[model samples]
Target: MRVLRKRMDKPAHLGGVLRDALKASSLDVDLDLYRLWEQWTDLVGPVIAQNARPAAIKGKLLLVNVSSAPWMQQLQYLKSEMMEKLNSALEREAVKDIRFKIGPIE
Candidate 1:
């Protein structure tokens, strides 16, 4: 049993460890995205909830739906400024753009 334990501890068998590290990194990315989505939506909720719904995409952009053309136009004007504020708040460049769409609402 002692010899078997020594063999099992060999550093040459680190392939499994490498795979686990990759998996953990992937999971970390997923969790980060989820948290950013939750935080950003919550941050912008009151401002846009009545006028839009937003989703985070690829950690680089936010897709928003506006119920009216006027709001869409307004949002377009503030896009970059909003992105800067959001990225600053998130402490990372989590969003580089905001895409607006017309919502299916009267």
Candidate 2:
């Protein structure tokens, strides 16, 4: 009679495994963008956050949906400030510019 043994491999850290998976799926950037969206209220404060919502991120540009045209116009004036705030909150230059359009907030 013969006995066989199975080999075991070293375990990878959870963070490293998650990083690898995100990279493999090209989801790292998407995840970061989603984080920005998720943290919109916390980053921009309740007033702005209530009037506008992050719609998408294309390259360094951020698309925002504003509740009304007046709000969109107001946000346009605060574009640079908003960008700085969001980037500061993210601890990275995730968003460079913001484009606001009048659209449904919810």
Candidate 3:
């Protein structure tokens, strides 16, 4: 007669496992971008959120679409502040700079 034994492994939290997978797959930045889009209003506040929206992220630069030229101009003055807020929320320096373009948000 022979006996067989099975090995058991500890389970990891789903969020942490997904985050690790993203980091390993080099899609961590994409997750960060998704977070930015998902939490834009809470991250930046309703006013900025209403006038500006994240369009894309290239390297450390963040491209934003503003509702109007005046809003774009206004956002220009708040670039550094916004970067600080974004990076703080992301828990990393994923967004280093911002460029605003006049465009429809949708």
- The order of the candidates by TM-score, greatest first, is 3, 2, 1
- How far residue 37's Cα lies from its native spot in candidate 2, in Å, is 2.2
Compute the lDDT for candidate 2.
Answer: 0.84
Instruction: Write the residue-wise lDDT of candidate 3 on 6-34 in tens digits.
Output: 76497779999887888776487677778
Residues 1-106 of candidate 2 have per-residue lDDT tens digits of 8898776598779998897998676476687678888888998889998999888777778889999989988888898988998889777887878899988787
Model 2 residue 55 CA deviation (Å) reads 0.5
> What root-mean-square deviation over C-alphas does model 1 reach?
7.6
| Best by the lDDT measure | 3
CA RMSD for every model? 7.6, 6.5, 6.4
Off by over 4 Å in 2: 1-26
Candidate 1 Cα lDDT to native:
0.67
Task: Please tell me which model should have the higher TM-score, number 2 or number 3.
Answer: 3
Off by over 4 Å in 1: 1-37, 40-42, 104-106
- Ranking 1 against 2 by lDDT, winner: 2
All models: lDDT? 0.67, 0.84, 0.87
For 1-106, candidate 1 gives per-residue lDDT tens digits of: 3455445554655887875885566564465456655665565655665786664354466766788899899889988877776677667776778899997522
Better of 2 and 3 by lDDT: 3
